[model samples]
Target: MKYQIRHRTHYRYTQPLRSAVQTLCLTPRHTDTQHVHHWQLQSPTPLQPQTDAWGNHSHVLAVGAGARMLQCEATGMVETLGTPLQSDPLGPDPRLYLMPSALARADDALRRSALAAVRGVEGRQAQALALTALVAECVRYQPGRTNANTTAAEAWLGGVGVCQDQAHVLVAACRAVGLPARYVSGYFHARGGPELASHAWAQVCLDPAERRWLGLDVTHGCVVDERHVQIAVGPDYAACAPVRGVRSGGGGEQLTVSVEIIPQD
Candidate 1:
């Protein structure tokens, strides 16, 4: 399956009188399961392409003084070619994912939750599925209840969050159970089905010897397949945020993002 993805972000500031710098992780990666056909980015400022510590393709955008309204757009075509379940995992230190970040911190509550979810699950894949389902039940998909900085324990207790929070909870729970899991930011192409501009999921290292990672979408309670286009992977959302920036002077900024993923013929 091939998908044409478009993501647009607009920033409106109440007062702007200086410069801005941003880092973007909007480019799809070349993995065993997916390939980037063509990609392009549009921003008011020039972008310097660079790869991050986790091997994600990133761009650094810098805008000069006197910039009020800023817009960043990314358009690309990605082909999901192979079986995601059988896909070869990219060689990275799995321990990095096992280590918890602030946003994915785990505690006694999460550990108990993990133990409960994996009870009687025989294999890693089965445990992953069970945990995904548990997370789906634990966290209702409710926006505005949490923000990007929401921790896994917070979301687990709150029982309501968006995909990011759900993914964080799943990641934390997997780590608690000694399964290496990471956060994945991507686009989901629904192929004339329900439309979502962008999405987040969790990936677990099920087989260390085989170097295979299982992708699970806790939000949708399904295994990630060709419909998923992965862009970045990290311990949590903070490391893989699509856009992060520092500005000298921009007050009371409002951000709006629009995303579209259309299947290509």
Candidate 2:
């Protein structure tokens, strides 16, 4: 499956900004499942491109003073292999994903729940599926109940969150049980609407020795397929956020994001 994606982020500030620097993880990743044809990133200022520790394509955008607004756009065309599971023979050390991160850390209760979910699960893939089902039951897909800063424990306790929270819970749960997992940020081609087009999921390392990973969408309780586009991946959302930034002076800001994923024949 092929897709043309466009993502735009806009910021409006009441007061002009003195100086601002932003880290962008908007570029889609090239993997065994996907191929990038052409990609472009546009910003008011120049974008410095580099690869992060996780091997993600990243950019640093800096804006000078006297700017009341900022806008950034990323457009690209990618082709996905439509494979439900991924096998990365050249992936980074699987142990890196074993460690817990800030947003995806599991608590005692979460660990116990994870253990219970996979108590008798036969294989790694089966255990991962059980964990995915557990997350779906534990966290209801309700937006506005949690934000980006919400942790896996908090979301599990609240019993409501969006895709990000669900991903965090799945990642935390897998890690709690000694299974390696990481958060994946990307675009989902949903027919319902664009509300969930900007999606997230968990990639559990089924076999570290073989570098095998299974992508699970906890929100939907299924394995990832052609509809999912691979973007930056890391321990959690903070590491793979599309845009993260800091500004010297920007009083009261409003942000708006638009994402479009169109299927191509």
Best by lDDT, which number?
Answer: 2
**CA RMSD per model (angstroms):** 1.8, 1.4
lDDT of 2 by residue, 146-169 (tens): 998999999999999999999999
Off by over 4 Å in 1: 86-91
Q: What's the count of clashing pairs in each model shown?
A: 0, 0
Estimated TM-score per prediction?
A: 0.93, 0.96
lDDT of 1 by residue, 60-124 (tens): 99988878888999998999874555333454777677888999988898889899889888988
Per-residue lDDT value at 79 in model 1: 92
Question: Pairing residues by index, what is the TM-score of model 1?
Answer: 0.93
- In order, the Cα lDDT scores of the candidates are 0.86, 0.90
